[model samples]
Target chain A: MPEQLADTVDPANWTCPAPLRDQPVVVMGHGGGGALSAELMEQVFAPAYGNAVLTGLADSAVLELGSARLAFSTDSYVVRPLFFPGGSLGDLAVNGTVNDLAMSGATPAYLSAAFILEEGVELTVVDRIARAMGAAAEAAGVTVATGDTKVVETGHGDGVYVTTAGVGLVPDGVDIRPQRARPGDAVIVSGPIGLHGVAIMSVREGLEFGVEVSSDTAPLADLVAAVLAVTPDVHVLRDPTRGGLAASLNEIARASGTGVRLRERAIPVPDAVANACGFLGLDPLYVANEGRLVAFVPPAAAEEILAAMRAHPQGGGAALIGECVAEHPGMVVVSTGLGGTRVVDLPLGEQLPRIC
Target chain B: MPEQLADTVDPANWTCPAPLRDQPVVVMGHGGGGALSAELMEQVFAPAYGNAVLTGLADSAVLELGSARLAFSTDSYVVRPLFFPGGSLGDLAVNGTVNDLAMSGATPAYLSAAFILEEGVELTVVDRIARAMGAAAEAAGVTVATGDTKVVETGHGDGVYVTTAGVGLVPDGVDIRPQRARPGDAVIVSGPIGLHGVAIMSVREGLEFGVEVSSDTAPLADLVAAVLAVTPDVHVLRDPTRGGLAASLNEIARASGTGVRLRERAIPVPDAVANACGFLGLDPLYVANEGRLVAFVPPAAAEEILAAMRAHPQGGGAALIGECVAEHPGMVVVSTGLGGTRVVDLPLGEQLPRIC
Candidate 1:
């Protein structure tokens, strides 16, 4: 990892392809899942890994094998400060991918966990992480069926980095993706927003807002199932994780060719999170959340779906926040509480780095 | 990643559970897929993530989701030097996982790739790796369906690390596991061993054996399918990777409560790899191979299966190495080329570290 170390790899053997001239090197924003992340995928990954399922770029890929259809997803948790207030890296590792599959209306059944450990990491820490993953998978009613472990020399890794990939069963009648959003579809959020990002930031920056803010990193498969039980025709579902609510909305708008109009007043942001964001000059809508989900459904079934989500433990704060519109396609406009309309473009990168 | 850095985590929040008292801290051997690796799983991972499927400790887990029978597996590639003589990390990532599913008697259909990047790494290098993955997946007949990317601060990573998880369809009546290796089963290995381990070590140690030794890393799903075409009743299929041929044979012997008798003279070992291991004081028997597979099949169908395997491009070097015996259950004994018998116990760890 040090420059002085001599190794066989030249590190300059392969030059960047012509298409990647804009960014000769990778920046932090490239991993932000925002505009930069999109460009990276479109130019680099999507072109190299050309396939319909990957081209769609949804949270989870629905694949058909033989006579079965299943949802598969992958996520690597690289959150700074391995342990946060309400959760640890292990919690995010399991819940994040499970939630991705859940967002596709798939009943998450199994997960594959691969761990990259630093050479000198304490075994106790890894044990704790594994226990946390076990508990989370149990809560989500999924099995951690297969795994691989690799260790890098000290200073070459950030203690422990876990990449988990999961597979789930998608029901026959259910079809969901970001592109399913349509005009007039009502958008509802599962619960309070911005808790996860704020929690990581508070612990990272050592700034307290009088009250403790913990991450809302809980598994939401149950919440998703409850919502699906109410209606299988749900248009779209997204878990606002890395780039948060604004990013998800922007992607949906662009993919579906629909404009999104949000009622900022209806969006639920706890007072503590609001105060923290105010003090930090951060927008909660652009902040990340782990255990929350955004659902777009036909307006007719929105109320019932909202009711079902609210009844679930993971979605106690469900609220109807917006609706898809035909005007200003590929744009998201918010009607602020201050009685002004604001366009919410996807941030070039996430406000908080490594806030997963 | 430096200790002086101010972070929220204390790194001492959790204590090692009672069961892991033997190894107070994780070492490189825990990832070696040998004795230490097995101990970690049995003592730490298995207890925490308790499930029947996980307890089996197979290369891939076969699950029944609804009416679908599928195989799920995961692997992380942290091989140092990034690029090697014959292949790169990207090729290893895809082929490793695909071969795992194929060993489970499944047809690899899709893969999920997650990358952890070190900030400031060249995007061109990333593009090359992605292209390599695309080509490997194409050769393996699998789609790169879903993926995630995260970047850590410059010093917290080794340029690029890839973790790929794959899911594939398991044909009806196909059951393959290490525990299925029984007495009277013929042991056949596809292609030469030790090439991959020697290739990696040559680059890492700056050793040259007059002749170039390239890694024998290739996709083996088609070869596995060819074997299956001859017969689905094959007892065990193992793609010797991290722990190499010796480790795999030991595991199969222990798992099935049978003894493995090998004719060392018949086990294919290229002269270059043999000479390299000789100079390095390494055992070619414990060296790794990426594209090779060791099959345990009934003696009745061994010839036909061998013929089918030899007919495939990936299995041109296929040779019958040995057979399972009831004499020394849970042990492996090899008859050497020098007309002497040698007991091959699993190495406590691996001779080559971070090798695929």
Candidate 2:
């Protein structure tokens, strides 16, 4: 990091918004989807572009545009290695934004891709990435409609960074938002966790576990559509990405002002992922996953939704991992298999950066 | 430049798409929004992701999404020196996307901002930029609805690069596009040209041309609305941005299969801008302007629309500088004062890189 840039920032000039007054310069944590990232959104972006829809701060903003209900979302892919074990940055870029819209009960239709290319990256590499993106978009049933490209001087950027913005049509009569997670809701997770972060780390650090761990990067839009088919009001849905499951749970609890109680043993973590996390001294609960989703459904509809999700190929390992409770509002507590309970706080930063 | 990255590019791997068979690597000209930029879009991107709306290659893709007419556009701003004389990258990002939608005759509504921040950028600099963005969005009557942030490793990124994607509602009965320009249509300019490019060159090179030239980087949506009010049948509206007036004119001529003839004395060029360009061996017609636009109007309604544009403060310097002709289709010719005519070809690349 450049010390000169940090030296130029005066804390007093920030006007010190309450609870986040000390961050005089941006740290890697500010980009992690954890408490620091939330604070950045709340203190900086939320106030600057203050609007009801924006302040809602959902995975996707659901807008009602002139007789059309739309879900809009965006994601930037900055993974270290352009190509990973199970997926490249291309597929991740497509799946990440597509899942964000799916979480809002929308059928994603179109996307805008903007690329920032470093000056001397190989043209063949870009071509390969573009072809992967094309194939991914075809699989997801969306079009890469509009794009812009900018080239930065060499060494001033990583090879290429892609930012994708998407628009989709939200299903009628379905209103899903973070604030709708009530105390009587059942929280179910689709498949295993921690695969994506582990996969990226394996490639980046050149460390291999006994088994090759591949990223679980896939589109969950169809799975979401299945759940919505069973019941329109699914309460809250989120893909555990960047800061992972723990951070996602904490965000929903805070947004709904309710408590989330997770049965630790019920949460499914693949043996490979768990072993890798153990060896690296990282918590599986704080590791990211690209294709998995956590949904909060009313007690009466939980069974049907879980059944629907399990029937889908992407969610064959779906499990009822937890429930929302009224005991400790705005907190998440994990019930240990050892007959003890522990608070699961949001991580200060990601255990691994650029794991998305 | 990283020679290793360049060395990996095999020209044979590209398959040598017709017309663009030569360039093996992405050059700065590919992003210049001129012929090379268009060719890159036509050859590389269009073939990789083939779709109807994308192939149109309009300023903004007009879409019919669930009974709502929408215009989707995106732009990436990599302007060096983050802060310029009259504007920063913040407002440039906001205005650039807004103007793109305005060219499609859309009421600019919402924007998505994604920022790639270098690891050590100062918080104060980011704060100031964010504040300017907020003010610009307010002025343009649009909201920054969603955002994403990523951090690159130090030395692998510029201070910051912003990419904005915007969605707006296109007004009914307005079919403004590049292909709409036709023979005998009057070509009108909204304001003085070349100020933005000169302003950045002045700061980047530390040179002065006897007079300080400030960038005209304000949002032009209001001026567009004023023009559309006079006549909904305006042929085409385009903001002369990256490659300036000459490039935009050539693009329209090629798209509409017509020729453009401009009276040299009628084109508006600020004295300072002309002097600066002359000193730097740059053509005033090819230098960029942020807050300026060119319109193609039917001869019958040209006078009323020109009057309407001149009435707005942003368009106070509006003038009728040229006309579309059937002769020499796909070219732009300027008539000299001595009754001689010379053709103005699209530039191979930008005179100034990262000038926004």
Candidate 3:
């Protein structure tokens, strides 16, 4: 019977998709969550896992199970040096998926933690990561409901790679997805950007700014709840993690077939993070942010939502960074500080790989 | 802040749980799903992720969601060589979690796949695996709802490691858990055992029996559904993947506080698998099996369920293997082929590691 199953898949006769034809082997960029990442999905994963829910390409796939609307999402953390400036892989493992569910306006509820460990990993190290995850889950008001652990030979793996899958209840009447972004919607960010990517790069490159930049690895569930309280008609919500703000905006624009127009001065970038990115020749817009979200909402309710975001502790620095435009579908245009407009594109690959 | 969250978990003052105290570092046996696996869970995972639902230690944690009972489980496939005689990692990835959800008496619904791939792996190889997963999911009647891909440096990972988390819906009036096993319950196995473990070992050890051996890596969800039609009061069900039939019986006995009495001659082991195990000095009872199940049901309904199982293509070799007893609680007793009896204890560690 196994052979019968094998007969269905003729790998030898399968044709390579055009975008992926040149790249015969997977590169680090394919996992970078940028243009290459999109190519991989369109060429490889979409054909394999094409479904109404998954093709939506949201952070979480919202499904109706019985009478409940559930949001499910998954992420794997391969961050180097388990511990970072302010957060560890444990925090990323929990908060990353929690934030993904939050983007769907779901009440983050349960998580499954699966770890792939290399042989010879100290139990104490894993213990620390687990406890950190426990604390994060507690902070986010979720439970780690199931877990699995697999150990590979010492040479087959790095220290530890954690994969976390989350299930949250998407409240009724809340339909937040990247594809819902529309022209004339306001673009807002919850807080400052680039700190997380800078913090990780600082550690990896052994470079120090005048002031240290720590990861903004906080759970955004509460902040998202606050936003939902203001309005259920929110169009899109995205957590810019891997490919950063640029990739998030470009993806939203592409998904919604709209253009994005941003004011350069309106975007918040902390001095330390700005200096770090400048020194590293990295764009703050393309640098990742762990505890931040970009929202697309009706222009009418934008100010009220911005006020609500500003009142919350995690979103105190929230601002209206841009607006969706009717021109140049699937493009992002930023007005420079000098009054010149330039196009912004998703990075070919993330400069800082495995930051999250 | 991240620091405030860190303040709660004082890693410096945290004490290592006693069961894990001696093993300061992870070993291959910890992932073996036997004694070491149990110890790691009880000591490490339980303390870190202890919740009412997870402490049950069922294959899939059953959660009560709005108007429905949901079952969720996670397993990561790190089986070496990617492909073997009968199955690939893709088949195992899809079937493994589906079987886990099936053990909970649930209709497997959705799966999330997270891949950890090493850089420089061929795209065609990944394509083959993805297509295989697609075919398997289609055959199993589940969707790959969401997915994530991460790339580690070449030396930091094997070719590809896939972690699959599944969600299923437990039907009304169908309750199944290992602890539900009762003293009068009868034990039945769906089909032949030890084929999967032997198949992998044969390839790894470069040994062959006179006849070819192939892995029995098929989804058991449908077979489980067929058995459920016979009776809804199934006491316990397990796939016996990593630690095999002996471990499954032993765990059931321990969980239910009952003794398991098996007739050695009734258990099915294919000739090639038995021959291969004998040549390798391996115990067939400790070998892995996919696409199979060991069920504990009321003795009155055992014959009907066995007939139902035998009629199904996947369960053609089904047989009544054993029964549960009150005497020698928490132990497994087997009557030998020579008319002697012996206690079958959970192995200190599984003989075959990563066989799943």
TM-score of chain A of each: 0.93, 0.93, 0.94
Q: What is the C-alpha RMSD of each candidate to the true structure, in Å?
A: 8.0, 5.7, 8.1
lDDT of 2 by residue, B52-158 (tens): 67666577888888888899998888898899889999989999999999999999888988888887788777777777889999999998888888877788888
Segments in model 3 whose C-alpha atoms lie over 4 Å from true places:
A1-21, B1-21
**Rank ordering of all candidates by lDDT, starting from the highest:** 1, 3, 2
DockQ of each: 0.68, 0.59, 0.61
The ten-residue window of minimal lDDT in model 2 chain B covers B1-10
lDDT of each: 0.87, 0.84, 0.86
Q: How many residue pairs clash in each candidate?
A: 0, 1, 0
Model 3 per-residue lDDT tens digits across residues A132-201: 9999999999999988888899988988899999998988899999889998999999999998999998
Docking model 2 quality class: medium
Docking class of 1: medium
- Candidate 2 residue-wise lDDT at B174: 94
lDDT (Cα) of model 3: 0.86
Q: Which stretches of candidate 2 lie above 4 Å from their native place?
A: A1-23, B1-23
Q: Candidate 2, residue B3: CA error in Å?
A: 28
Give me candidate 2's TM-score against the actual structure: 0.94
